[model samples]
Target: MHQDLITLKKICKPIENDLKEFQLEFDNALSSEVRLINSISKYIIKNRGKNIRPILTILSSRLCGEPTPNSYRAAAMMELLHIATLIHDDVVDDATLRRGRPSINKVWKNKLSVLMGDFILSKALINMVRLNDFDALKQISTTAEKLSAGEILQIEKSITRTMTESIYFDMINQKTASLIATSCELGAITTSKLEEDRQSTHSFGQYLGMAFQIKDDLFDILGNESDTGKNSGGDVKKNMWTLPLIFSKNNMTRSQYRLLNKLLNKKRKDGHILKKIYHMVEETGGIDYAKNKLDDFSNRAIDSISSYPNSVIKQSLVDLVGFNVNRVK
Candidate 1:
């Protein structure tokens, strides 16, 4: 009775051909005169993950009306900005792997990685100008700003180890949801140019992104390397406490809280550290609470676009929500 991403991808086949259009724009955006940069860019392209942002852009455009050329341009800009952020994030985290491969920062070292990220950002800006859509440009620029602020805030919180529920939501909203929200808004504006339509799609994107990020956080604690393509308890290593651990902290017994705090300060997974954290978090109902929130946010995302007319694209967006709910990887 449940459909996975493979099924959802099949359902969204309407967007398949247009995805090629997005790829062309993306390839053009990353093409550089510098040979080294071009090689790195090609490598990045070859190892790219799911183009969820662009897919959202295309689907949102169709849900509102017919997608336009500007939609592809906007999608390219969003993805470029996203890749730039990921490159910088890897450097900041000193991450060695990304999507199961050596990160650019890991392969090329910090200096070139940093410069490559800047180059991608500059290209995104150039593409934004070429799009000639002032509204889309504004949304994307604001999202770019939000991404930086979110990472800084998360870093600050991780060091202090004092993240509250409100703070966590705000952090994820900026870091994850902002671009998704803007992606849908850009799509809507590209097709309709209507304020209400754009707002609806933006809301849909924000809520879906919220659920998406919560799923990622869950995977940090519960997933295996084979499933997540990363080490288990990576968040713990990073000193970042996600929603489940934080909520559990709030409800933990005094002895449990102190022990948890001490373990977190160690910031290294020795024998049984992760198992202890998981046991304590589950005892306090944090995982269930987070799951409830995931459902709540996914429902809101669904409601946001429920008013749209019946169409396969709309159904595909709905299927995406279902896929997010049931996703294991």
Candidate 2:
């Protein structure tokens, strides 16, 4: 993880100072008169994850042209929306941990967690309105819709056990990729009004996010809690068969399929069963298959920005592809 940050250090340097300001704005945006809200907001500020979304926003702006005065504000809104989703996600998943700390839901219980998520969403929307960029507003609003719809879709698939390759792609695209795509689009529009550049950056973000989510899913199966800073295989425990599991199931023999299905149903929550499942996934090339897909998307993302002239910012965007796909956490 330290090495991962090192790889992105050059990438993030271009916007490092701006990101600091953005962080301050992010913290300030959460301020409220209410007592519990302030406490929860402070906790969120303290335990925030890497501000990758906002950095991406700033870098995407630099890649196209000079960012507007509202660039960081747009970036802050992105982070706010992301944090809100995470707050809600923990409650829905009943997750006990986030970034290796006790989750908001765990510490404050479901009611406060859900309300905090709502508060963040309201703040993001209010900030978006203040920005007064109709196009960017539309982009982010569409993203908010996708995020909610995607989770519902994933939960439905998990409940019905009807997740196909196509549905899986759509789920990840909406749940993870849409906001990233919006981040890039917002940046480009804030910097340059050129529709072509905006579209191009949005595509870059979408492809990059696809790879990013799949890589995360890979970690969900293979990573340690200490390394990933979250519950490993929690998705599987909830019957959310991600790419690796889906591919591995496809490769199983009749008896093996029966065994795996039975184990997943009976022992999905069992940590002991995961080592065996991981081994089976590896032996059957499930991990290899997902890695291939990840590589494909990473390359696609790079290609999306290839038209941009060589520059520090361009190289940073390129480096981000490697950083995201290679990150273990």
Candidate 3:
């Protein structure tokens, strides 16, 4: 494992027991009578990623105050929402793999994948209802809408080939940042009951998530499947323009831009074409541009929480910003 990932483990050390309780809550949230649903849920749990969202929820809660049972439920709800989106995204993208394993769509086909995604989403909704906090319900509901709208907007931009830096940010904000923001806000809502604290953590999570997605954009070009556990250059393959390609488009010459567009418009791109596109973006300094933005957002995230008193939880939140930008996968 990468040292950054180890750093994440250390960051979670402060809330190790809370995370354990969260795991139980998460497991219970996914429990169903249907055998197949149970099997798939088990697989998802077994193949879970870093549990970053839940960590954020728990940490944000601690930073503002103590975590309550509702905080764990909120955390589980956030993760279930994220997982549902990923399952649906794989089906939409026709992706075969996720986190270095065959995707749900690949294993069970798109039809089943779609239904399972719906099932998981329903579970998320159930958790949301159980929260019984009007403020939290509103926040989570808005996030759900934004998540769907973000995906639709991305698909629209890709089909129209009209992706720009502005649209890219808007897309990521809705699709990714909104959830993280809610995770932090929900933590405050469940515990702190202070609007100022809620807003602080929300802003922090929003900036961190923006940095997170940009890092994913960089990984698409620079990272391989073995490292990223994802299909590299997937955005290019799907003609979904990301930050690097979007930033580079204006910097390239007319001919270079035309050639790049031509390749992107193709129904299929071979290794050579993908390599050429990567070089075009690289030569125009797209990679560096993205890294700069990643750092900018990371700093913004840290700044959002600057007023909080120094403590292990606060330091973990700060470390999380670094981990998000530095993680290899």
Candidate 4:
């Protein structure tokens, strides 16, 4: 196992029992009488990645106050929503693998995958209603809207090929940061119900999420499929502009810009073209620029939580931020 993953386990040691309870709630929430749904749900459970959102939810709750049954329910609901999004995303991307296993669409086909995503979304809704917290419901509903809007905006930018640094940050803020922000906020809502705690954790999550998305974008250029668990250069292949490419575009000479445009216009790009693009971005310091932004967001995330008194949970949250920055996958 990667050392970062090992450190993650240690960071979660403070909330191990809380995580176990959350697992029980999460498993219970996925149950269904329909055989196909059950089978798909089992497969999802088996193939799920590190339950990062739930961990954030639970840890935030602990940070605010003692964990409650409602905290677990909120955690489970967040995980269900996250899973539903992934299922839909795979279908949209025509992806064959997820978390290093055959994607739902690959095994079950797109139609079934879409339906399964809906079913899981319905389950998430059920969990939300079970919480009976109006604030939680409202936050999650808004987050759901943001998630859809973020994805739609990405698709629009990809089609128009008009992505900028500001727009890139905006798209990721909506698409990725919103859910994580809500995850932390929900924890405070379900536990301490303190506005200060809520604001701090939400800010923390938003910053961390921004950094997280940039890291994933970096992986698209620099990481291999084995390490990333998804195809590298996917953004380049799809003509989806990410931070490195976007930064590099500003620095490119007229001839280099033409070459980039030529490569992007191609119906299919060979590995040689891909390698050249990678080197282009690297030489222009695009990778370093993105890394600097990532570190900025990470430092801001740590600063967001500095007001909280020191504790194992507080340190765990701090470690979580570092873990994200250092994570290879």
Candidate 5:
């Protein structure tokens, strides 16, 4: 994992510099009468994330042709939208921690946290309008809607025992993958005139996003809480259906299914029961099966990017997919 981060640093150095510049611009752009909004926004920015979405946007543009001012703007917009979603998600999840730190709702009241999320989302949309690109605005707006719908679907299905693999895939695709696909497509569209390149870039982002989420699902079952920077077995606690749990349930005997169903239906907090469920999932090859699916999605991501001309940017994008697959937490 250490070596992978080092390699990622080398691959992402140039893009990181560009991303930093964009971040500066983004910080400068956030001005409003709401001082509390600014404070919350700054707090959110203080704990920097992996910047995967913005990096993808910039790198996709460069791989298609050359980086431009428009690409930088789009990248900044993408990050803003993502951060806003995180704020909203933390609220929805009633999560106490995010990225290993106290979540906004934990620090402040839920009302303030919810308002902050709305403020950030409004800022992102305003910036998108400033870009004055109808297509970009439309794409981002649609992605945001899909993300909302997906979240609702997941919440509705929480603790459901009958979730199918197809439903799980569909949920992740909408919840996690669509925004990523938009980032790449918007990046290419900002820098390139070729429709084919734009489509391919979107495909690359979609596959990569799928792989990324699948890895996250695996981590939920197998990762340490400290390593993942979130509560381990959070999905299990929420009774959210994921690929691993779905596969494991399918392979369980009638008696095993009855036991698992009882645990799922308990509606009570019990660590021992959760651990038992985790062990059952592992014994059923749930984690391994999810990993294999991640492998397939990662390969598809690589293939989607392979169509582009060779460059450091392309290689970096490919390496990102590799990192996503191998990431422990």
Candidate 6:
């Protein structure tokens, strides 16, 4: 993972100077609130995330034309929105750790964490309004709504035994892909005048985002919890039916299905039965099926960007899809 981040840094070097400006912009945007809230917000920023979404925004903008103020603002907005979601996600997952550290809710109380999330999200909108870009505002607002809807859908489906592939796609599209699409669209809107270019960028982001989420689902089943900074088999433990579990369950015998149902419905605190179910998912072709789906999405992402004039930035975007799908952790 260290080496991978290094490689990503090398790839993003061209935009390094611009990213610095964005960091400053983001820092300046965070106002000094009451001492406790300010401290919590600063703590959240100190444990900085990967900043992948913002990188995508900047890189996509560079792919189309020179980096502009709008690109930086958009990147900052994307990062703020992403951080807000992470804060909320930790609460929903009852997650104790994030990015290999204690989560905000774990360190502080849940109420404080929730309010911090709201603050960050409000700051993002305030920045967008400052940009005075109506289209950007509309796109981000729509994506935020979709993200909330996706979360609700996932919560609604949690613990259910029969999650269809289509429903899974829908859930991921709203939860993960919508923000990515907005990032790319915002990038294109910054530079490109043609409607087709903007549409293509949006499509590219959507495909890449889908591929990214599918890969993440695969990793949860097969990856090291220590490396991913997430508890392995969390989906199973929470009785949340992901794609792999769904595919594996479809192939189970009636007796196996009964065991699976019993396991999912179990009220036990310990996760022994859930571990067995994860092993079952591995034994079946669940992980393999997800890999194939990831490949399909990656290919679609490549196709979406094929129309762009060949440039280093465009090539980097293509390479990023490959990286996202093949990431082991």
RMSD of each: 1.9, 1.3, 1.0, 0.9, 1.7, 1.7
lDDT of candidate 1? 0.87
Cα error, residue 312 of model 3, in Å, equals 0.7
lDDT of 3 by residue, 44-153 (tens): 88888888899999999999999999999999999999999998998988987799999888778899889999999999999999998999999998999999999899
TM-score for every candidate vs. truth? Answer: 0.96, 0.97, 0.98, 0.98, 0.95, 0.95
Tens digit of per-residue lDDT, candidate 1, span 1-329: 33455775776699988899998999999988899999999889998877888988999998888888899999998899889999998888887768778888878899999999999999999989988878877788788899999989998998887789999999999999999998888889889989998999999999999999899888887777777666667887677879898899999889999998887777468648887877888889989989999999999999999888888898888888888888776
The C-alpha lDDT values of all candidates are 0.87, 0.89, 0.92, 0.91, 0.83, 0.82
Q: After superposition, how far is residue 306 of candidate 3 from its true place, in Å?
A: 0.1
Where does candidate 3 stray beyond 4 Å? none
Tens-digit per-residue lDDT, 1-329, candidate 2? 48877887777888878788787777778889999899988899889888889988999988888877678899999999999999999998898889999998888999998999999999999889988889888888889999999999999999898898889999999999999988988888888879988999999999999999999989988998999988998887878979998898888788887877877887436678888778888888899999999999999999999999999898998989999887878
Evaluation by TM-score, superior candidate among 1 and 3: 3
Position 322, candidate 3: lDDT: 92
Worst 10 residues of 4 by lDDT: 95-104
Better of 4 and 6 by lDDT: 4
Tens digit of per-residue lDDT, candidate 4, span 209-250: 999999999998898778888888888889999999999999
Distance (Å) between predicted and true CA of 183, model 4?
0.7
Residue 55, candidate 6: alpha-carbon lDDT: 85
Ranking by TM-score: 4, 3, 2, 1, 5, 6
lDDT of 4 at 79: 92
Q: Given candidate 4, what's the lDDT at residue 13?
A: 97
